[model samples]
Target: MAQDDKAARGPSVAEGAALVDLLLQMADDDLVLGHRHSEWLGVAPDIEEDVAFSSIAQDEVGHAALYYELASQLGAGDADRLAFDRPVGERRSAAFVELENGDWARTAMRHFLYDAFEEVRLDACTRSGWQPLQRAATKVRREEFYHRLHSRTQLHHLAKAGGEAFARLEHALADLWPYVASLFDLGPHAAELRATGVLPADAAALRSAWEAVVVPELSELGFGVPACGGTDATSAAHRGAHHPALAELLTTMRAVLDVDAAAASW
Candidate 1:
């Protein structure tokens, strides 16, 4: 069959599970981080940033909805339920996103790092053999350009300011670096996804692509760029495990829905 025809028909039963796994991973990452970003609404360092982070948070949640919708079509259940109702252990978001947003510097550092990784991941998804994912990724990538710009610009300004600003950012990077590899862990069906071209690149290739973009930029900013691969045992557990923070986050995130279970259906 032609490539387009294959994509239009969707993945075979054998590939369906892997495709759903990939979709949930993408969706959960955005959803969890978006919630974290939203926490800055009234409290960001400045009014301008408050608005910027709010807008960025909206975009990330919207992107998550897009991915969740795709997963729902593939029989993952309602998008809202998939996002809000999943148990902590069932969530596929990386540990990096699940961590509480520490401080302004930590938030900025996480934003820059996650956006850099997202750029790489989404770029690869744009070329995926799955046409639906390719199209959705293309849409998300357009909006992500501004996100990357905002994060990079923030990092540059903070780095150039020196003194405590630079020190804080450096500290944030060190604290966050170990969890970075978890973002590239692609879940259990990674090999199948790569073989079927559902994901155009495997985790290692994606990580390398991410490093090429970030490592030099970070070095130029005078930050010590750490080695790129290898997750700690906790982070290496992929989607099967999560930090304790995620459980707390979910309770708060689902607070309203928990009260009104019917809200999720709407």
Candidate 2:
């Protein structure tokens, strides 16, 4: 198909709503988690990982902006305002992204878990019949290749090291699993998304696929994940709820935008 032809296929109003719903969930996840990862700029285990993580943060934020631009085309809002000006309750990020970045182990574990889910989601999006998403997913999935490797390498080394390092990694896994599993929550437009082929599957199907990949990988790393990830109720809570940490992060993130005059360019 020609690129121009693909770009010309705009969604109907109802389909646009589904598209917007998916876009907001993805944009919020990337935007919020990008900020969380940015918190580790100077605090990762070493300068190498710090720089690597900073790049990952930048990639995530770029992905967020891409998605927000797609939303803006659908009449959501400008990317800058959509990302920075939204009320806390209006964002649809999975609850896990809202968690505070802890020590090295916790941060790496969160990255591994999140990157795993993100890889799967990008794969699904690549299969979306929607042209804009198809292009974005293809591009983002290429970048995620390095992210997946970087995160998995960190988790593997820590888990295999044994002693305090191994113990800390195991503890991080145990502590983060509940929140991390919520990444698959698809928010309120699952049916429309699936029906329109904007998403390849419903939340439960994607959650199962995520577990199929992540569970055995964790088991191989020698930590038994105690819970079965998120239930329907938990998924709803994860998609709908905001953690206290998000508010704090937003306050700092929106500072420049909030204080400046409306027409000021930065």
Candidate 3:
């Protein structure tokens, strides 16, 4: 049987910290990117898209909250503290989530790319040896299908437009490949995570799989993706390293939570 086959089965002491780290990797990305997507709430180009992005934002934030709660159960910290109090350098989210969603092109393509990577990560998490994390990931995976469909549909529309829309999407897609490269990194606890069955794929394997899905799709849309290479391609950024934008983003996300001074409710 799997180590975490039973609902009450727990990670051993040797693997507990690794499990929490993995949870943070997943949770931090969701929380930060959720906030990023929320920035488009009232400002999206079209009203219909605005509502769709809003719903996605809510799902991502809710997923983050569940992971944080799971981490709390593991003695990491309370959900709010874990979300609001961590320094940018301490966060495990990728540079992709932290980058500015500058325009409709940037925003739409970024959303598509992120949704693609997230689909892979969440699928892996659903198979985790840790039951609670598995359950949380499995539950969240249902909501992600809609997000993927929405992003994929938008990309198809923009790419087929064959004029300014195609040009813009091509540019945005190229810009995103570097950041997405880091999405699957296993970080310091990589060995422990795989050894314990907490996660299944490594950074390289996951990136390759993501590319196999995305590159062809973008090419089919007439976007020419350059062969990915260098540090950006390899994704040296993970936990403990961060883009400056992350600090700015965290400041905005923490604004309200910092003011309340430990209140029980918002």
Candidate 4:
């Protein structure tokens, strides 16, 4: 039987909690990044692309909501509070999401890198030794597949279109690649998750898998994969110290949410 199959039939309370933590990390990353992405809802360079981008943004937030619901079931509190109420420092998202959306190239670059990593990570979760996580991953993977495809489409177009778009995409990739790998950091829950057999793979292992999945695609797109030289604590960036662009993005995203603290519905 698969590890998840065995986990499904047993009393694995510890593994369940570890899974909850993992879920929170996954949900939080998507929520914050989606919020940043949605800031471009109507301002995309072209209307058709805007609409398509909006749907991807919506899918990410929707994915976050689903993961939050699962986390709440395991006692993580309501999704909104978990999302909006937390200060920036408490957020577990990597620095990539916290950076400003520069141009379409930068936005697309970030999306392509993130979506590629998310796919590999979510695939691991789907086959997780923790049963609830396996089920959650299965549902999330369905939506994420489209996210990856959308990003890949944008990547192809940007690479094929020369001049400004190509330059922007290349610049964005070089700037963001280091932080992209940091997405799998998993923070303090690393050892506990592995001990419980919930995560099964460590950050290093997952990073290797993510690189294998993304590098070839990027190379084909004429973008170079980030090298191993920049791997150090100097590369350890976090969302706590956000770019000035992040503030602007946050203001736009929370415009409605900031209206009334007690607003009951979104």
Candidate 5:
């Protein structure tokens, strides 16, 4: 597509809504995952890594807020309420976001996997037909650039560490690879968004793009790619399946917010 053509046409209202829903899921996944990651704040294995990881976690939360703001403008509800008040099952986020921060290796694996996928996904959005979404995508793509850098740095270092770090990276990848598929499970919007050109690509194409990026990275790290099926794959790592640590993380993350009985400002 030509830049002038894209600039001239932009996105229609309905198309923008479709784009916002996609953005919301992206944002929600990052937000929840970041909150889980923050549990490692003071406990990170090293100070420099802790700082780097913290920035990624913060970026996720910031990205979530931007998506939530868009959703709220579209009448989805206020950002905080949409983020905090929804029941877990109502959340459109993939199960990967809810995984426990098992160890630095596991956390780093999550970062690597999610960031790798998000980069492609956002790039697709950056070229969206809708102006608002396209603009938002441009901004988000910039932020994710850093997220990818931070994650890859950790992934490479840990994989090369050749001790507990290596073991941790291996185990984390083994655990996270299954749920990685869920990131592209675009669901009912797949057709509608594609037809409207709201999404520049379809789920199958997105999945392929993700694999193209992710597989090579994993290979370089000496890890094998994990198999993925739809939600019916029936494994401990299946989509929609939440980790045991998720409940605990939610409890702590929401505790302060829950205390105010719904009317309090965050």
Candidate 6:
């Protein structure tokens, strides 16, 4: 088939599955991390942050909905079901998002790192040959711009606070760095996704893009940046085998539906 014709008809069955995998990876990460962010709604250190985190949580979940809708249109199933009803083993979320939100410093660090990762991922998606994904990514990237700004500003402030605040953030970065690789793991369909132009870049390219942004900023802030060896066992676990926290999180996320499984919609 000619290139334009192939693009017009969209991906083949195998490529569609790869696209679904990519979409789920994007959706699951946002949904899980958004839930984690929402946990701070009532208990954030201050009123301003309570509002900020709450808003960010909403944005993340909204982005997830966008991706899930796209995936559903491609025959993945109902968007709501895909978000809330999947078994833990079937989820494609990276471990970085599944970890509990630690202290304020840790949360801030994770927020900064994840936003950096998302920025790169969305940038790549904007160039995808799949028009739906390209448009969806462009839309999501607009909101994410502010998210990255907020997280970056918050990190700078925390880093400048010195003493205990500095120490806590440093420790958080060290602990979180290893899991950063998981965020870039594109799962089993990575090659197909890239070959078909569903994603313009592979996992390594995405990770490199993330590192280019994150490393320099952290170093400038005088924080010790940890080395990331990509695709380690820990990163591999995030591809299919998730941490126990994901199951607990899914339970909470599906609480309403769980009570009435026969309900038509959420």
TM-score on alpha carbons, each prediction: 0.95, 0.93, 0.92, 0.86, 0.86, 0.95
Give a tens-digit lDDT track for model 2, residues 1-266: 54345347678788888899899999999999999899888877789878988999999999999999999989998989899888888888887888887778888888988898998888899988788899999999999999999988878888899899888888888777767645776867788888877788876777777888888999998887776844645542567677678889889997877776675688
**Preferred candidate (lDDT higher): 3 or 5:** 3
What is the C-alpha local distance difference test score of each model?
A: 0.90, 0.84, 0.81, 0.76, 0.74, 0.88
Residue-wise C-alpha lDDT for candidate 1, range 11-92, written one tens digit per residue? 8887999999999999999999999999999999999889989999999999999999999999889898898889887899
Q: Show the lowest summed lDDT stretch of 10 residues, model 4.
A: 229-238
Q: Write the per-residue lDDT of candidate 4 for residues 104-208, one digit (tens) a residue.
A: 888998998888888888887876776777788888899888898888887898799978888888888887876664576776767888766677777877877
Which model, 1 or 2, shows the larger lDDT?
1
For candidate 4, the TM-score is 0.86
**Candidate 6, 123-180: lDDT as tens digits:** 9999888888988999999999899999999999999999999999999988777677
Question: Which stretch of 10 consecutive residues in model 6 shows the poorest summed lDDT?
Answer: 228-237
Better of 2 and 3 by TM-score: 2
By lDDT: ranked, best first: 1, 6, 2, 3, 4, 5
Clashing pairs in 3: none
Which pairs of residues collide in model 1? none
- lDDT (0-100) at residue 227 of candidate 3? 77
What is the TM-score (0 to 1) of candidate 3?
0.92
Clashing pairs in 2: none
Q: How large an RMSD does model 5 have?
A: 3.2
**Candidate 5 positional error at 244, Å:** 5.6
Candidate 3: 10-residue stretch with minimal lDDT = 229-238
State the displacement of the C-alpha of residue 78, model 2, in Å, after optimal TM-score superposition: 0.5
What are the runs in model 6 whose C-alpha is more than 4 Å off? Answer: 1-4, 233-237
